[model samples]
Target: MTTYAKIIVNGSPITKSNFKLHNINGRAILPSNSGKYHDRYALYEQEIALIARNQNPDIVLEESLIAILKVYYKSEKRHPDTINITKSIFDGIEKSGLIINDAQITRIIVEEYYDKQNPRFELELFGESEYEINYSINKKSIIDNPKLYFPIKKNILKRDSDKNIDKNINSNKNTVTNKNICAICNNEIKTKDYMTADGGKTLICKKCFNKLF
Candidate 1:
């Protein structure tokens, strides 16, 4: 809930699943083919742009950000998938000039619910530091026992894997900088309490590792 910007678009969100492809000069080209989609997308852009312009008129964010979207649907049956409906909303946010590009969004949180009388979605943006702090504070229990949220097999983190883990870490040691920085946060590793993920390709510091959990 630690958001820097928040907006609510009062309409059903559009999905990009209805895109149509065409042939131009024997080359395949895909385009959005639904007029309803365009209308809703334009509505989102206009509302976001108006709010952004009202605040600074020339504001644009290029830093890494987190987007949280809450969608309220009109019915419980045959609703669109959350993933399928994100593109148009993100594109609208991009077109609003509130941010230079949607590519700046490094994380996304989406939730859906039923709201028969008022179908709409709320969008909120958060900075990295704010999101990390808020998430850590609010989700402390989940982090403490990450295995509950992300279960692992009995043999995954056992003492038997120590030798293999050490070998992988040692082999990838040369890939890091002289300071041994964490690949995710770019912070120098000051203690031996660090580990690798993704087949030992990513070096993660203790703080970043805890955040992941």
Candidate 2:
């Protein structure tokens, strides 16, 4: 299990929902933010990028990822929604070039706590290899439908009476000799490494397919 980076950015976490509507050409359009929130949000993203680069100077993850985010508020007044903060955090990570893209993140864990003296955001990132190990270890306890992770394992479909069933299926369905790009994640993948979905109208890598459906 590899931990890619752990970054600490000091400030109150800002939700992506901090946007205001503007009346342009007699129509209301929502821009990125209002007056004060815009400057604050931009500074927040910049802080995240700078800290992430300093933490993992030479590392940029390209694999599927998991992000653990913790936000410590300065007071007990009103805590923002944890889910709403993910967008800004992910966008900041992308700006930092810590990961190839935010789309690589497959799972996230969010937590909020009160700390009157210190307000900050902590982020921890893990790659796909780590996720796989944890998934296998906690499969029974964590997931209600484990098949979603391993939809096409050979041992699950193997039969004592017929040893050629797995071979036959592989030869017929997954024996493409060319490499193709996944439609969902836009990652290059070997055709034989995965399968098509949505009635053969879309080609998705196993990781993206599993993450999606």
Candidate 3:
């Protein structure tokens, strides 16, 4: 029921302390000035943006997520714990519009390693969904079955259309007023709720297509 994605950076991992907070007029404030972690934050921002842009179906969010961490250190040195570093990481993810809030994370798995050469943290954000798993299996089955292949599918559609000419005529009149039937689920599909594939031939509802394809 879990789906995850990995995050990689061109440079080292940014620790919590690397983000500075100065007291301006007796109040703690976060400044946008460049610092040692500037490069790292830039990379984080770019990576987050990349992930957000290429979301599977480009919409829908998994309410519950779990983040697994593998922090790689360049050398044997004292640093903040992975748990402590999580706040900044989660904040970056949210800032990039990945999740509604970091509070949606149900669990955390943290591990550290000595990388000596390449210093970076590997983050895997897992989403809990049983439907995504089943959808993958079903899609694979459809691809593997030659008898139920797309050509056969088109023939089946043709046969069904031949038998439903009167219904089709009536449905066409109401399509604009009622709902556009989804090609996949045969359910009433709203314009925004349906996605088209194969240059507009294959239509699927958002609920069935959300981040699965």
- Choose the strongest candidate by lDDT: 2
lDDT of 3 by residue, 125-191 (tens): 7786521222122445344534342322344343444211224335656643334565444666655
Model 2 lDDT tens row, 1-213: 244788888877786465432221333222223232234666677778888888889888888988888889887566676778888788788989888899988888788887877888898888867554343334365557432333445676535543112223356566634336665455667545554433333354667544532
TM-score of each model, in listed order:
0.50, 0.53, 0.46
**Candidate of highest TM-score:** 2
In order, candidate lDDTs are: 0.61, 0.65, 0.54
Tens-place lDDT per residue, model 1, 1-213, is: 223777677766667445432222333222222222223434555565565446545556667798888999887665777777777677767777777788888888788887989998887877776665234425454445332334445854446423222322345555523455565566666776776533443455656545533
Evaluation by lDDT, superior candidate among 1 and 2: 2
TM-score of model 3 relative to the true fold? 0.46
For model 3, give the 10-residue run with minimal summed lDDT. Answer: 130-139
**Better model by TM-score: candidate 2 vs candidate 3:** 2
Name the lDDT of candidate 3. 0.54
Residue ranges of candidate 3 with Cα displaced over 4 Å: 1-3, 17-29, 34-60, 131-213
Give the clashing residue pairs of candidate 2, or none: none
Report the poorest 10 consecutive residues by lDDT, candidate 1. Answer: 28-37
